[model samples]
Target chain A: MPEHAILREVGLRDGIQMAARFLPTERKREWALRLKEAGLREIELTSFVPAKVVPQFADADALAAALPELSGVTASALVPNLKGAERALAAGFTHVNYVLSISEAHSRSNVRRSTDEAIAEFERIVALKRTQDGRGLVLGVGLATSFGCTLQGHVDPDRVFEVAAKVAEGGADELIVADTVGYGNPAQVKTLLPTILAIAGERRVVCHFHDTRGLGLANVAAALDAGVRAFDSSLAGLGGCPFAPGATGNINTEDAAFMLDSMGFATGIDIPALLALRRDVEGWLGDERYSGAIARAGLPKTYATAPRTAAAPALAS
Target chain B: MPEHAILREVGLRDGIQMAARFLPTERKREWALRLKEAGLREIELTSFVPAKVVPQFADADALAAALPELSGVTASALVPNLKGAERALAAGFTHVNYVLSISEAHSRSNVRRSTDEAIAEFERIVALKRTQDGRGLVLGVGLATSFGCTLQGHVDPDRVFEVAAKVAEGGADELIVADTVGYGNPAQVKTLLPTILAIAGERRVVCHFHDTRGLGLANVAAALDAGVRAFDSSLAGLGGCPFAPGATGNINTEDAAFMLDSMGFATGIDIPALLALRRDVEGWLGDERYSGAIARAGLPKTYATAPRTAAAPALAS
Candidate 1:
């Protein structure tokens, strides 16, 4: 059987970033705590960006204040630049995730920098994390547009490998491969993930995929079959890119958890609890175009009885 | 590398069966032909059932009359009993699909028969297929709720295997394992599909899966990796079970074909033409809540340059 997978909740950071309105600081804290209580060991609680640029994380400091109350949770926040990394450390986040796009056009349009410039920023953030105040901070790197880009179309695997090797050599504590524009497929995920893992050596890796083309869960399955054990998902499938108009966002946390648990990976998620939280979150973020399947179909009748293990015959081969 | 997979369009039959309103006969014929024009070789054109029961396929005869004009296309019709199969053969359908639920509860509620009775009915149908009028007809059997059932929940694999063995031995030309309510996951699929193939021996097999829990394409990927080809999909992911409310239907025909093509399988689907037809179909089926990723995100940037094949390492192993 495959190992237990970590499903890090990103609804607060990624999902909220695309929402039309900002959730209150306290509500964000409460929701994060609820997610942790519902068996998430890690949570990407918020992002450190200029409030004027993205108003959703305007109260990042206030939201990060209650991280200590999360008990055994490993909380991380997104930092767009070195200054944002500084803000993240100052706000009591011991882990920070820095994102960089691989596609030149996506880098220019999304982060207002070229791909090379984004890599340089990542190196700078690594240096900043080595400073006194940033000591003990685990700096993870996210490779946006690692799979495909809306602006650049198909991203070459050779180029992606080059960037991944750079991140792996640049001292990222973990590597995150993201399908930033939801243009990924199962064949790509199964083929590319092992190469990314080989580049990372011993560093842990996670994938961030979108449901823009409805292949999110299928890609997750491919990754698992490829030996991936960690994933990033949002509650209620709550996130979308500002650039990809009419596109949906990440795979649902509850739905992915259900898939993971059903596949016998031991995600330790409480389906009923997660579904209840999803309902509350839906009410909180009224009319935000929520997505998920288990929330809609209810849990499978055999959910508790027969969680099939991967130790079954070599069926995929 | 994996071989080319067959994608059989089920929108006209399964999709319309679930629609609140019946599609006009000429429009149904036009849509099926348009589907064929977009490179679809097989289509479940319609179902042979009483108009008083379904109302959507009430014009089954009218729709079947145009099958000859399809030229080289292979057309199949769904049948609930031997009588329906007889109707299908009389109406120029060279292929007929017989559906049976493994879940006794589902069988009772769906077709008003027990599981044993359903198997017995399959035997009777096989006898009828050997008769003079049905001599050259191909009798395909669909194992409904083979994965799980909304009524019974978590269908037993042993029971499904027994039914599959009987069907294969009783002369089923094709075996279609169906996730009637979408309670299937990738692991369950990868494990079960190979066993189904083992029971099938030399017979061809297809899968009819719903996206109720968003794992439709994932199941497809698993089945592909398991060496099974041919799937039943509906346009824009249409079709649903009345038993499972809030459940969406099959994987999108265009999206599944796109994934198959991108995965280096020569499905021969013309994405642009299919998308155009989908737009027209969407306009025809207003308020129907269509589902698919390719429709919203469009095609990828690398669609023309690169299509990844399965030979790229043992990623899924």
Candidate 2:
């Protein structure tokens, strides 16, 4: 178990945003509270994007308002521009995530802005964070399509590093390298993570991977070996990138936690508890596909020997 | 791209053994020829066990004799004992695979033999092969449940190494480490592969993984990083161990080829051609469940830039 690895639950924001039917605000709040109680320290609660463009997240502010004020638990929102950032701030979120696509074509199609203009907006969001009443709203920037793009293939590593460095210099508290199209392999991750880490430094680098090509966990192992400690995952492997065709889910949170916890990494998260949460999410979605293994096969018997409390009786039963 | 990877297609032997209905002998022969044409060097063509136990492979002798004699391809069969090995040799198979489960519980349930008895039988099979014809006959001893066993829960690494060493000393040409219950993680792989490789220094070590827990490719990457060059996979992700409950599907052959090819490794096999052959297998097993991503999503666009011919036409189209 490494001392620094962190797993951020993105099912609320990234997962629900891609669902066909909108989850009620009460259900969303219930999930957030249960997830935090399951030992997740940080969660991407919702996106602050416009209501008209993504109606699924129309109740982001209401959900944000209902979040339990747990000490040491950080609730964050995704913001595409300065307007989204302002809304997130107004909703009282202490953490804001701004995503900018590194591929010009994908950026233009996804956010309707050129790469440079998106970076400019990121700078504006960073500047706005400084003037707010110092509740210390941390700003994080994600470089989407940092691996390869659907529209533009073979995104340059230099471009990814450059964007990462620029965002860090512009006052982003952290920079996440994302495989938006799920086009990355372990070799690609090995090639790209060092450069991004070198530019963003050790503490600022977070790795986000997709399971589109079935290389999600392999990519995570590669990044972990390369010294990445923070990861973004969707519960039950929910969510698909609307812009990236066939990009159906992020890495499964329980699967990732199981991998880390079994390897002696302290995730501080309960594996079976997270798996139980998956069952609840599945009931809500009915037949919609959700990806994960811990939900299918209960945690291995050896899990009890690890440094964690006994799994809940209800979950084990 | 390493120079020594051996991708053994197990679709015919392990994949179809559990199928409810038997595929026509001609269809199996067609699959053999197509796989050979696609440049798969070694294939587990069928099992030579009693027809009463597995009726699906009742035509093993006929199917083996019908295979096209290609220059680089080596046809192999799974032999449970000396009788099965004799049958395989009589049918002109140049290679024979002997199964020896490392876990005592699994070995008993799977073959009704103790681990020591299985190893003794392996030695007898090697002796029998040597007495008849030695040149073209390659003997590979597969150590199933090397990582962990479903019934036993934890397989001791020392026991795995000792059995591998004893098998190698007894006359096996190659050794394969199998995660019989899909209980292996990258960390466990990292810890075990080196020890196995060190003990069986002269013999080739092939890794056999199942996607039961969705860590198949991750295990491959870990083994590859640890210098393992050979792997075992089934087309369309077919096959499940009857003795190892909850074990479903070997690592998908097409998906493994795609991952290796995408990472700059030359499998020598054609990716798209394999996908087409996968469809043929799927058609044969009318109601069977088949899995793999490359067949569903096609190859990533970067595949076109490789020094390979165009892929075969899509299976569904």
Candidate 3:
């Protein structure tokens, strides 16, 4: 396993998508800027879906256009199909995540397409990324419900491997295995992560987890032990599984960072800054429920970054 | 790692100790009985503390005497010193957890004794457990703040090992490493658990963690990976560090059972029964803050406990 891990803040994209009220374009831009300021090197800023269906992300183009100003940060956007990919490319987004529900039932309900159709769409998105001029866009194929599905119950691991093998053969830059409804357990992660990594190769896989069953961080630990170096988390734990009844939000970004950093994995995140942003986001979305423990408990006193060493005095007292 | 793990439900003792409203002695006994109904073989029923400081457990004697009626259940109580231990013996309790804060500052604040003094008391208690006639009692020395301390900040691991060695040599039946203030991370557990276990022996070490920072279950995962088989958890994620500001509560018992059972570890727990008890506890402790995601999300659809195999049919449809 790598000594470092990358935690991609996906609150703006996944979190806002499931929210009850829409945050304005200006607030979304503010959130993006604050995320960058909080030392997030990579962030999924928005998704290019139908503005009518996901009105909250109607400002995806604007957010994508504003990414150039934040030169050091890698801005990512979720694209559902070839049309979404084109818009992402037009807006100059260098990273696009094309998500597909591995379960056929979830695929039809979520995207109005079958699993094969979604895979075909992913191939087209990858093709679009290749054809773009002077653009270094990276296309990642995300396997949603890769662990299990709420609608279909237990998804066969063989089917997940089949989809993963196809995505790998399709020439995507990255492969994402997501427990969309948080049906994964640590044992499953311990067993399946190695297989996923074996097919995707090193540095090609990202693990996305939800706190629906409170096993999000445990699954993260399992993936870490399995040598995964990148993960997806949301600030303030903002998003929940729309299909999984009474599910909580995504893995909390600050909590994940705290766990990783404390475990000696260098994540390059300023946790206090993320906590500050979490506070701001909490204020902005005032009645909406947000979940994360670190925000409530604060960091441990033994937290390494909190200026533990005292300054040397010129003369003894 | 052991194929079977024991999750000792400590909510009645630790959780109710911190609550604003006091559960009557009858409710406490009812909670204990329900814990057994939920398939928890071991439970910390109450604490033998002064009623002036902790009125919630004022009926410890009554609970202890009543525990004999709950067949197949190993009832335990928290005893602070020799006096409490004597009371526990008089009440005919067979298991006692003698807690001592490993951090000097925490030890002074919690029990008004220094670390060495507390260790000396533990030695006395062990001697008492050994000297008693016809009392087949088991004594566990719980080293609270073995991970980190809210008052003293970073606790040295060397101190923890020293305490473990002393308790092991003092003839205690078990050694408990407690993250009293929830400052522990997985790396610490990975490094410290083996050392503690080596000193205490396999199945002789118990892990006590708080979800104050949300790593409670993650820490449990770490401990499980380190070959430790016993854990301490609460009913509705109740109980917080009285000394640690903003700390949430203990690891939820239902959450722990779900994770362990799903991971193929036989905890001998009926998760649905625990959830039902959790609901009852929630109703009793109305308006109090409790945490646990499984209660909200319900069990996974792929959960196997409910008659997974289909009965043979005469014909197919």
Candidate 4:
């Protein structure tokens, strides 16, 4: 088992993109800085998508330029296509995440491309990264709808691994398997994550689950049992599934961090600080549905006065 | 691994007791019959508390009488003391559940008894059941705050198992471990449930978790992995923690059943009927903070036409 787990903050990117209101660039930067202060080492700063499509991310370049203020935090951005990758690279982001749907039907509906076309785009993105003159840019591939899809349900594990193999072969720095529509359960996670990990190898695999059906943390538990140590979560659980409106959003970062810390996984996260940010997000995104339990009930008294480290260290193994 | 899992619906007793308005007797009876139609074999009908104290269950006798209408469902009632036990048995309920808090503080505050006194009450309840000439009633012993307590903080696992042993020795028909305040995590469930099952044996141990901190289904997964096949849940995720206002309530029956069924655990539930009932509850408890994600998102299309059986028998082993 790994000594420390990595939680990549995706609120600024994935979360704000789905919001009903436009979050100012300054608030986005503030959210990032607070995340850094809360001990988030990796932060998905923003997405380099067309401003007309996702106006919330129009400040993507501005957020990327402000990353220098968040010292010690490794900043990353989402790139939807070759054009987005160009923008991300121009913004000087060292880490770029490119997503492709594992289900062919979802791929066509979501990214407006077939699975093969997406894979070919990934190859082009990798080639673009390789040709960057003096920049050491790394590209991460996220397999969306890896569990099941809203457009085409029951995505095959073999299909997910097939895309995973292509991502690995395409010289990607990270391989993330996402239950984009929250259609996954723990059984699928335990059964499929290990195979995905085998292809991605150590320190390269990530799990992203939405809480659309209230199994986000359960899926996270299964992935952890399958030896996954990295996950993507949104602050205040900001991003509700587009497919399942009025349902829960992405897995809440504070809640997931608290669970991991309670279970003796060293998350290096300041849960109290994250909880404080949850309150701020609630204020920032007024009337936007914010879901998570720890923010309401508070932490167990056992965690009080304890060091900000994994509690029950012996249990981690 | 068991061929089928049992989900005891506690919506009537536990869920309605916490609601803002009193649910009428007919509504309670309709809820039970609906639960039976949804394939629940066991339902906690109502508590045998004083009508003046909890007016919601003032219809305990009326509900018990209506249980005959639910042909295939086992009707159970909550009995807090020897007085409640007498009432339950007099009402001809075959299954009676008596709760004793494992946390001394919670026991003193909630039930107005010390832990030792609660155990003594359990002994008395068992004695009462044994003395029933030909009633053949079964007594279920529930250890509330078995994981942790809001007032007492960390309830020791050793202390919980000690009470489990006492319940087992007292000749109770069932042993239920409940996280009353939802302070438990997956690691705690995985660690404690096996010890609980060791004392109670198969088909005798039950896990009751609240989604207070959004770890309800995660804890369910851990308990399932630990070989627990019986769980207690409420419809539409009704019932908040009396101790923690605004906290999540009991684990949602539909969500837990869906996860277990998707994971190849034979839950034998009619999910669509449950989902429909959830909408009714949402309307029934107007502005009462109803929850559970599956009711909004609906089940995956993969499970759309599949029979209400375990999807994979091999993985369960």
DockQ of each: 0.58, 0.46, 0.54, 0.64
Please provide, for model 1 over A123-156, each residue's C-alpha lDDT reduced to its tens digit, 9 standing for 90 to 100.
8998887775425889899999888887878789
Best by DockQ: 4
- The order by descending DockQ is 4, 1, 3, 2
How does model 2 do on interface RMSD, in angstroms?
A: 3.3
lDDT of 3 by residue, A1-317 (tens): 32677899899988878787878777888888887777778889999998998888888887776787677888889998999989888888888999999999999999999999999888888777778746777888899998899999899888988999998888788998999999998889999889999998743799999999999999999899998988999999989767987887789999998888788777777788888888888887776668988899898877866421112111100
Candidate 3, backbone clash total: 0
Would you estimate the TM-scores of all the predictions?
0.94, 0.94, 0.95, 0.95
lDDT of each: 0.85, 0.82, 0.85, 0.84
Higher-ranked by TM-score: 1 or 3: 3
**How close to the true structure is residue B16 of candidate 3, measured as C-alpha lDDT?**
79
Give the distance in Å from residue A84's predicted Cα in candidate 1 to where it truly belongs.
Answer: 1.0
Model 3: per-residue lDDT, tens digit, B1-317?
32677888899988878788888777778888877776787888889999888988788988876676677777888999999998988887888999988899999999999999998998888788788746777888899998889899878889899988988888788888999988888878998999999998643788999999999998999999998888999988999777987887889998998898888777778888888887888888776678989989999888877531121111100
Query: Which segments of model 3 are wrong by more than 4 Å?
Result: A306-317, B307-317
lDDT at position A137, candidate 2: 81
Candidate 4 chain B: worst 10 consecutive residues by lDDT?
A: B308-317
Using lDDT as the yardstick, the better of models 2 and 3 is 3
Fraction of native contacts under 8 Å reproduced by each candidate: 0.84, 0.45, 0.82, 0.81
Query: After superposition, which runs of candidate 4 have C-alpha atoms over 4 Å from their true positions?
Result: A305-317, B306-317
lDDT of residue B315 for candidate 1: 10
